[model samples]
Target: MNDSPGWASPGSAPSDEPDRGTEEQPTPAADADGPAAEQPSPPNWSKEQPPAGQWSSPGIPGQSGPAGGATRARAGSIPHQGGWYGQPAGGPPMWGAGWSPAPQAAKPGVIPLRPLGVGEILDGAASTMRAHWRTVLGISLIVAAVSQTLVTVVSGLWFQGTGRKAAPDGSSTPALRQAMRDMADTLAGSAVTSLIGLLATLVATGLLTMVTSRAVLGRSVTVAQAWQDARGQLLRLLGLLILYPLMIFAIAAAGLAPGIILMATGTPEAGLLLMVFGGLAATVVSVWLAVRYSLASPALMLEKQGVIASMRRSAKLVRGSWWRVLGIQLLSFVLVALVESIIQIPATLIAFVLDGQSLMDWANGTADSAGWTFLIAMGIGAVISSALTFPISAGVTALLYMDQRIRREALDLELARAAGLPGYGTDTTSAAAPGAPTDTSGDPTPGS
Candidate 1:
């Protein structure tokens, strides 16, 4: 049996050891006629020589002496063999045995959470769009547009412009426009306000949830895909969307229970006290619940969970992470507000200026505001603002939702598995619905 070190370490393990050591070791069969067999006296001790028992490199044997036990084969110790690793003649494999591994870069489409600077969020959104443009662009645009649309309609209904309300066209205002616009600030507008709020909430929740699911998967999908994925579960999502704020309202309203006891049988002061406590409790409850269940939309979109399931999932994912989400949300709100103020204020100021009213007259609410042109322009400005602001806001919420799951469940790893990326965990396709806007569970190929 031949037990050469080159055959041992870089090559192949030495063939099973000879049964007994004392017998003269048999030379390898193919090499019997080779030069080593023909050598009469000279033996090169330094190279191509290995100790008998299971050799591993311990130290390079000094030129003067035998290595203590094991030998450290020097650079030239083994002859280079090409066909072993099937390299072309005269060159090594691109990645050779001597190469050390490199540190891997972050997976594409990931949003890192280190303190991001101005435009970081936009950059993240743009990167996501660039990477999964086919997957993300249409859906993002659709969602963005729809979200903006809903917000625009709702805002138009809820907040009155300074002048007569015109039809969407810049045409003349309707006969009852002033009355309707005036009623916007009255109790009668409550119904219109609630309905608009509900619709807006539903659209935003479904879209943002989809964004979250795709983000976690490190995948991008389009509006059609998102809409399709969400179409079936939308009612449920809407219910959930309405439920959250409603629950908060209910809790806050509960504070009125004590005051109601006094008022129901007796005095106005009891009712007043109930209103005060109820209002305060509602404020605190609403804020906390909004933050707590922020993740619920994605949970539903990805997990097909019920309202409770989604809420619980969100609550669990956000248990200790509320403040971070809150801060991110607040930041987004400020951006939205800043951008909106910048755009709308000028339009408003222009309207006030052109209305032929003095500054004092306008401030005193006695200004005869500009006609339908001003209102139409204001509507256009509002729509444009909503279009730009809402999409990014939706994107951030979705991104944040995905990030939470990634941190808690190693969802990114699971997503990698789904995307056929190396080093991922179990594939999660089954967790998503059939016909859902996900393409992660397929094999990946190069050079199609």
Candidate 2:
């Protein structure tokens, strides 16, 4: 388990028994060696060479020497090629060779309390869902049902029928007129749905971020508890949600407005060129800003920051890793889109088949469609799809925020401690604690 402690267990302590002698005495050799060559000067103890049965270097042997009974191997020596590591051929073994280093602890939570890999981030999100399915799925199901119900109601109210006017030439043109009306209504409905969806998303993000914080510590959170922790930050998060898109819209509009005016005044060629070029430029800026402020909501909810402050915090966190963050976010979005399409496409096809109208005729608003049946069926499918999608999207966003903090702030250590792992102090605070002061002694702020 990744969360398992790296330290050895207590039972691994070495014994303190003293060493014993096991030397074999040299025989007299029947006085044939002529007094053993004058007893050869006693070997020096201070020389570089080790005594017999001792190691010189990793693989080299030292000169032999006489000793009590038998020679003592040098202390704390590495084992020879095939030797057992039981009692070294010398004194008592030093402490701590009794056990191998303890296997690293399991991560014990949605993620290992360390810098996360891309797969780990995705896995963490899935892990959170699996661990707290009731809370996570409940939040998503409620939000999805409400959002999809609103869409169904809105579509029923505004999308069923249309009024048409005669052409300027006094010819009937119901198809063209109906198409125009459909387009207008669809755009209007999309705008309203987007607003409602954004509101739901803000609330969901707040609740899930709280859940994720607890999940990081391997603790499950209830929906009510999540709401309690999250409610205070929702307003600021919602403000951020509103303000961020407005900033993008404002940039795009500012870029395109001049070109629009020129085209309206009849400089079609120049206006077209400017519109295309300006749009491209605005797109580049918008994507950069999107990635830059991506962490703002999590920063606000987790750090208890104000709207503008959260934006600043996000900017601080994102400073050096823009491309990486952007890639990961884009990948997450693609996966979300894929999941939605997989589930919703079949539902939509089922709705279409059950509606019993020719595709062309229905699209042209010429068929007597089963309006409520179509709307309700589609709504149900949408609800199911959204329910499955919401948790993943929320989890990914929250984990990405944490991953960034881990990289920038060494947050994994704090998380490990918070998770009650060994080697980490039990009283240490969370690295993402709201408004926590950084240790400015030598620490580099994100900007630095």
Candidate 3:
């Protein structure tokens, strides 16, 4: 084999001749200066070649000598045939035989440029928040404070007089009416507050997606920069967020509608049985679809895709990784829930203690208003929980999308170039490497 660098294949070798060892040796003529010719060689020529198989290939272990025990070639020397330093043509190089250790992947930012494990994904998210706390936490805090304040105000004013009102005579009819009234009021208040929060969450997700992308490149971004980068796609992102939940709701409602109709027509027992079966099937379907499209948000933000296009991109990426995606997403949800509970529980207890009278009135179904102190304290807790949890949730999602891309599309090369890593950014050949995505238009493609 050719022992020269850049000659990876036998066909590229400089010659096809057999080694000189196979040729017959000629008798040497007497030296013109016989005594001087027998003298010891000069210092430059005195060093003897090391024994065969003395060196191993870099990065590879255990292998000794070149392929087939052929003589080793010096560095920068070219062999007439065979492979590098006697490595067999078409075979890998031996350790220390014209080989160097592979470069460690470039890690300019939160994650190394490679396919990531679950722990690494989680760690990358946390690292992004830690490394760029001011920008990340600032975005979270603003969104959380605004959303939580709206929710608190709506709960306080809209449901102040919504407690159950039993009649003086203790009639079942009045008690039933009051229960229905309270249920309706609670649902209405919850719906309004949830909508407010959802809007806030949409904005936070878009901005944080941008922040996490930059973080992965080992770059920090300010809040304004994140906003600028993400602003163009915010509407499409909002459309995606709205469409995904509506799709889930539609599936659930379709599953339950048949049962509701049957019950209304007076077949209560059969309707109830059907409802249970239908609900389970619907839940399975919903979960499958949710995992399939969980990556749409990041695709929309980074790829500048339309809502439908982004969803299609996500589905393509997640086609064969449904369970893995679901597991990671579920883990993130559990973590966020735990964080929220830890922060809010103490605040809730404090609020309850400070407004015991209002709590008692509500318990007795005689509350006329939500106490200001209680509402304020609970809102503070909500804000704090949201502030901390938002970054984690958004960071996990963005990083997960990146991980999927790196695994399936060889995205790390592009990321490395974007990060300006040496060799990666300057290599013109990597663009044509096998399995590397070549499309630069940002259009949604099944394999890209």
lDDT of 3: 0.77
Ranking by TM-score: 3, 2, 1
TM-score of 1: 0.58
Compose the digit string of candidate 2's lDDT tens values, residues 217-318.
Answer: 788778888787788788888889999889999999988988899999999999989999999999999999999999888888877779998888889878
Task: Give the residue spans of candidate 2 off by over 4 A.
Answer: 1-106, 163-184, 362-370, 428-448
Kindly list the per-residue Cα lDDT of model 1 for residues 293-370, writing each as its tens digit.
887776776666788988898888778777877888788888779988988888777765654446676566565534
The lDDT for every candidate, in the order shown, is 0.57, 0.73, 0.77
139 Cα displacement, candidate 2 (Å): 0.7
Per-prediction TM-score to the true structure, in the order listed: 0.58, 0.72, 0.75
lDDT of 3 by residue, 39-66 (tens): 4455775468754334445555555454
Cα deviation of 198 in candidate 3 (Å)?
Answer: 0.5
Weakest ten-residue segment in model 3 by summed lDDT: 439-448
| TM-score of candidate 2 to 2 decimals | 0.72
In terms of lDDT, the best-performing candidate is 3
